[model samples]
Target: MASSNYEVIRLKRDLPAQGVVIHQITDDRMKTGVPLHDALDRLLEAVKGKVLLVHYAKIERDFLEAATKRFYGKSLPFLMVDTMQIERRRLERTHQSIQSNQLRLAYLCQQYQLSK
Candidate 1:
Protein backbone atom coordinates (compact mmCIF):
# COMPACT_ATOMS: atom_id res chain seq x y z
CA MET A 1 0.00 0.00 0.00
CA ALA A 2 1.35 3.39 -0.96
CA SER A 3 0.01 6.56 0.57
CA SER A 4 1.30 10.07 0.83
CA ASN A 5 1.64 9.73 4.59
CA TYR A 6 2.31 6.02 5.01
CA GLU A 7 3.03 2.82 3.12
CA VAL A 8 2.51 -0.77 4.21
CA ILE A 9 3.78 -3.84 2.33
CA ARG A 10 3.02 -7.35 3.46
CA LEU A 11 3.69 -10.94 2.21
CA LYS A 12 2.53 -14.44 3.03
CA ARG A 13 4.62 -17.59 3.23
CA ASP A 14 2.50 -20.30 4.89
CA LEU A 15 -1.19 -20.94 4.83
CA PRO A 16 -3.57 -22.43 7.50
CA ALA A 17 -0.63 -22.69 9.93
CA GLN A 18 0.68 -19.23 10.62
CA GLY A 19 -1.22 -15.97 10.44
CA VAL A 20 -0.26 -12.85 8.48
CA VAL A 21 2.76 -10.62 9.04
CA ILE A 22 2.69 -6.95 8.21
CA HIS A 23 5.37 -4.33 7.68
CA GLN A 24 4.50 -0.68 8.21
CA ILE A 25 6.55 2.20 6.87
CA THR A 26 5.87 5.75 7.93
CA ASP A 27 7.57 9.02 8.86
CA ASP A 28 9.94 11.49 7.24
CA ARG A 29 12.07 8.75 5.74
CA MET A 30 9.30 8.44 3.16
CA LYS A 31 10.36 11.85 1.92
CA THR A 32 14.05 10.98 1.81
CA GLY A 33 16.04 8.96 -0.70
CA VAL A 34 15.54 5.69 1.20
CA PRO A 35 14.69 2.92 -1.26
CA LEU A 36 11.41 1.11 -0.74
CA HIS A 37 12.98 -2.15 -1.96
CA ASP A 38 15.44 -2.07 0.95
CA ALA A 39 12.58 -1.50 3.33
CA LEU A 40 10.71 -4.42 1.80
CA ASP A 41 13.81 -6.61 2.08
CA ARG A 42 14.02 -5.80 5.75
CA LEU A 43 10.34 -6.54 6.12
CA LEU A 44 10.72 -9.79 4.19
CA GLU A 45 13.60 -10.85 6.45
CA ALA A 46 11.45 -10.08 9.47
CA VAL A 47 8.63 -12.32 8.27
CA LYS A 48 9.80 -14.71 5.61
CA GLY A 49 7.48 -17.63 6.18
CA LYS A 50 4.38 -15.83 7.42
CA VAL A 51 1.16 -14.83 5.70
CA LEU A 52 0.78 -11.13 5.08
CA LEU A 53 -2.32 -8.95 4.97
CA VAL A 54 -2.63 -5.44 3.70
CA HIS A 55 -5.50 -3.01 3.15
CA TYR A 56 -4.90 -2.75 -0.61
CA ALA A 57 -2.99 -5.41 -2.53
CA LYS A 58 -2.80 -3.98 -6.05
CA ILE A 59 -1.25 -0.69 -5.02
CA GLU A 60 1.25 -2.46 -2.82
CA ARG A 61 2.16 -4.83 -5.62
CA ASP A 62 2.74 -2.01 -8.05
CA PHE A 63 4.86 -0.02 -5.69
CA LEU A 64 6.88 -3.02 -4.59
CA GLU A 65 7.51 -4.04 -8.19
CA ALA A 66 8.68 -0.57 -9.13
CA ALA A 67 10.77 -0.22 -6.00
CA THR A 68 12.35 -3.61 -6.47
CA LYS A 69 13.27 -2.88 -10.06
CA ARG A 70 14.85 0.39 -9.02
CA PHE A 71 16.72 -0.90 -6.00
CA TYR A 72 17.22 -4.66 -6.39
CA GLY A 73 16.90 -5.12 -10.18
CA LYS A 74 14.09 -7.66 -9.74
CA SER A 75 10.61 -8.01 -8.33
CA LEU A 76 10.10 -9.19 -4.79
CA PRO A 77 7.58 -11.77 -3.62
CA PHE A 78 3.92 -11.27 -4.48
CA LEU A 79 1.35 -11.82 -1.73
CA MET A 80 -1.26 -9.61 -0.10
CA VAL A 81 -4.93 -9.03 0.74
CA ASP A 82 -7.29 -6.06 0.64
CA THR A 83 -9.17 -5.71 3.89
CA MET A 84 -11.27 -2.89 2.48
CA GLN A 85 -12.54 -5.17 -0.27
CA ILE A 86 -13.31 -7.90 2.23
CA GLU A 87 -15.18 -5.48 4.42
CA ARG A 88 -17.09 -4.18 1.43
CA ARG A 89 -18.13 -7.68 0.48
CA ARG A 90 -19.30 -8.39 4.00
CA LEU A 91 -21.15 -5.12 4.24
CA GLU A 92 -22.84 -5.74 0.92
CA ARG A 93 -24.01 -9.11 2.09
CA THR A 94 -25.30 -7.63 5.32
CA HIS A 95 -27.07 -4.76 3.52
CA GLN A 96 -25.65 -2.29 5.96
CA SER A 97 -23.01 0.30 5.82
CA ILE A 98 -19.94 -0.99 7.63
CA GLN A 99 -18.56 2.53 7.80
CA SER A 100 -19.57 6.01 6.75
CA ASN A 101 -17.35 8.43 4.89
CA GLN A 102 -19.11 11.44 6.39
CA LEU A 103 -18.68 10.31 9.98
CA ARG A 104 -15.44 10.01 11.91
CA LEU A 105 -14.64 6.85 13.80
CA ALA A 106 -15.47 8.45 17.13
CA TYR A 107 -18.77 9.71 15.84
CA LEU A 108 -19.60 6.35 14.32
CA CYS A 109 -18.74 4.64 17.56
CA GLN A 110 -21.09 6.91 19.44
CA GLN A 111 -23.85 6.47 16.87
CA TYR A 112 -23.51 2.70 16.63
CA GLN A 113 -22.93 1.85 20.30
CA LEU A 114 -19.32 0.89 19.71
CA SER A 115 -16.74 1.30 22.42
CA LYS A 116 -14.53 4.34 22.31
Candidate 2:
Protein backbone atom coordinates (compact mmCIF):
# COMPACT_ATOMS: atom_id res chain seq x y z
CA MET A 1 0.00 0.00 0.00
CA ALA A 2 1.13 3.53 -0.70
CA SER A 3 1.32 6.30 1.89
CA SER A 4 -1.76 8.47 2.31
CA ASN A 5 -1.92 11.69 0.30
CA TYR A 6 -4.28 14.40 -0.87
CA GLU A 7 -4.70 15.82 -4.36
CA VAL A 8 -7.32 17.48 -6.49
CA ILE A 9 -8.19 16.22 -9.94
CA ARG A 10 -10.42 16.93 -12.88
CA LEU A 11 -10.75 13.75 -14.83
CA LYS A 12 -10.33 14.43 -18.53
CA ARG A 13 -13.52 13.88 -20.49
CA ASP A 14 -12.24 14.94 -23.92
CA LEU A 15 -10.24 11.73 -23.85
CA PRO A 16 -11.22 8.26 -22.71
CA ALA A 17 -10.33 8.37 -18.98
CA GLN A 18 -10.82 4.82 -17.80
CA GLY A 19 -7.91 2.63 -18.67
CA VAL A 20 -6.64 5.50 -20.79
CA VAL A 21 -6.02 8.63 -18.75
CA ILE A 22 -5.98 10.03 -15.19
CA HIS A 23 -4.66 13.44 -14.27
CA GLN A 24 -2.75 13.83 -11.00
CA ILE A 25 -2.95 17.56 -10.42
CA THR A 26 -0.50 17.80 -7.54
CA ASP A 27 2.36 16.84 -9.81
CA ASP A 28 0.61 18.00 -12.96
CA ARG A 29 0.91 14.50 -14.27
CA MET A 30 -1.19 12.92 -17.00
CA LYS A 31 -0.65 9.23 -16.44
CA THR A 32 -1.42 6.65 -19.08
CA GLY A 33 -0.34 3.18 -20.28
CA VAL A 34 -0.92 1.95 -16.71
CA PRO A 35 -3.74 -0.34 -15.65
CA LEU A 36 -6.85 1.35 -14.29
CA HIS A 37 -6.38 -0.50 -10.99
CA ASP A 38 -2.97 1.01 -10.52
CA ALA A 39 -4.21 4.40 -11.53
CA LEU A 40 -7.09 4.17 -9.07
CA ASP A 41 -4.63 3.20 -6.35
CA ARG A 42 -3.07 6.59 -6.74
CA LEU A 43 -6.48 8.22 -6.64
CA LEU A 44 -7.77 6.27 -3.66
CA GLU A 45 -4.75 7.20 -1.63
CA ALA A 46 -5.95 10.77 -1.83
CA VAL A 47 -9.69 10.16 -1.49
CA LYS A 48 -9.83 11.19 2.16
CA GLY A 49 -11.88 14.32 2.97
CA LYS A 50 -11.97 15.48 -0.60
CA VAL A 51 -15.02 15.86 -2.76
CA LEU A 52 -14.37 14.91 -6.35
CA LEU A 53 -15.53 17.72 -8.60
CA VAL A 54 -16.99 15.86 -11.50
CA HIS A 55 -18.83 17.36 -14.45
CA TYR A 56 -21.63 14.78 -14.27
CA ALA A 57 -21.11 13.03 -10.97
CA LYS A 58 -24.17 10.82 -11.05
CA ILE A 59 -22.80 8.92 -14.01
CA GLU A 60 -19.24 9.39 -12.91
CA ARG A 61 -19.99 8.02 -9.44
CA ASP A 62 -21.56 4.86 -10.80
CA PHE A 63 -18.72 4.38 -13.24
CA LEU A 64 -16.07 4.87 -10.58
CA GLU A 65 -17.68 2.50 -8.10
CA ALA A 66 -18.23 -0.17 -10.70
CA ALA A 67 -14.70 0.14 -12.00
CA THR A 68 -13.25 0.09 -8.52
CA LYS A 69 -15.14 -3.02 -7.59
CA ARG A 70 -14.19 -4.72 -10.80
CA PHE A 71 -10.52 -3.86 -10.47
CA TYR A 72 -10.02 -4.24 -6.74
CA GLY A 73 -12.67 -6.81 -5.82
CA LYS A 74 -14.24 -4.18 -3.58
CA SER A 75 -15.56 -0.66 -3.89
CA LEU A 76 -14.06 2.25 -2.02
CA PRO A 77 -15.99 5.14 -0.50
CA PHE A 78 -15.57 8.68 -1.77
CA LEU A 79 -17.45 11.97 -1.95
CA MET A 80 -18.32 13.73 -5.18
CA VAL A 81 -19.71 17.11 -6.16
CA ASP A 82 -21.62 17.22 -9.41
CA THR A 83 -21.30 20.57 -11.07
CA MET A 84 -24.21 19.84 -13.41
CA GLN A 85 -26.55 18.87 -10.59
CA ILE A 86 -25.59 21.93 -8.58
CA GLU A 87 -26.17 24.16 -11.59
CA ARG A 88 -29.58 22.64 -12.15
CA ARG A 89 -30.56 23.28 -8.56
CA ARG A 90 -29.21 26.82 -8.76
CA LEU A 91 -31.41 27.52 -11.79
CA GLU A 92 -34.47 26.14 -10.02
CA ARG A 93 -33.82 28.05 -6.82
CA THR A 94 -33.12 31.29 -8.66
CA HIS A 95 -36.19 30.78 -10.84
CA GLN A 96 -34.06 31.12 -13.92
CA SER A 97 -35.86 30.32 -17.14
CA ILE A 98 -33.29 27.88 -18.40
CA GLN A 99 -33.73 24.54 -20.06
CA SER A 100 -32.47 21.45 -18.29
CA ASN A 101 -30.19 20.72 -21.21
CA GLN A 102 -28.49 24.04 -20.62
CA LEU A 103 -27.13 22.59 -17.37
CA ARG A 104 -24.44 20.87 -19.40
CA LEU A 105 -20.76 21.11 -18.47
CA ALA A 106 -19.84 23.36 -21.36
CA TYR A 107 -22.65 25.82 -20.73
CA LEU A 108 -22.07 26.07 -16.98
CA CYS A 109 -18.34 26.48 -17.49
CA GLN A 110 -18.89 29.13 -20.11
CA GLN A 111 -21.37 31.04 -17.97
CA TYR A 112 -18.83 31.05 -15.13
CA GLN A 113 -15.96 31.94 -17.47
CA LEU A 114 -14.28 28.62 -16.80
CA SER A 115 -12.30 26.54 -19.26
CA LYS A 116 -13.74 23.10 -19.80
Best by TM-score: 2
Q: Candidate 2 on 10-93: residue-level lDDT in tens?
A: 434334444343332332243324456666777776666677877778687887888788988887776877888788789889
TM-scores vs. true structure, each candidate: 0.51, 0.64
lDDT of 2 at 112: 92
Which lDDT tens digits does candidate 1 get at residues 1-116? 33223333332322222222222233332344344556666766755665556555777678767877777788877667665566567768889865565234344456567553
lDDT: worst 10-residue window of model 2 = 23-32
Model 2: which residue pairs collide?
none
Error of 1 at 89 (Å): 0.7
Q: Which portions of model 1 show Cα errors greater than 4 Å?
A: 1-34, 97-116
- Clashes in predicted model 2: 0
Candidate 1 lDDT (Cα, 0 to 1) = 0.55
lDDT of 2: 0.66
Backbone collisions counted per model: 1, 0
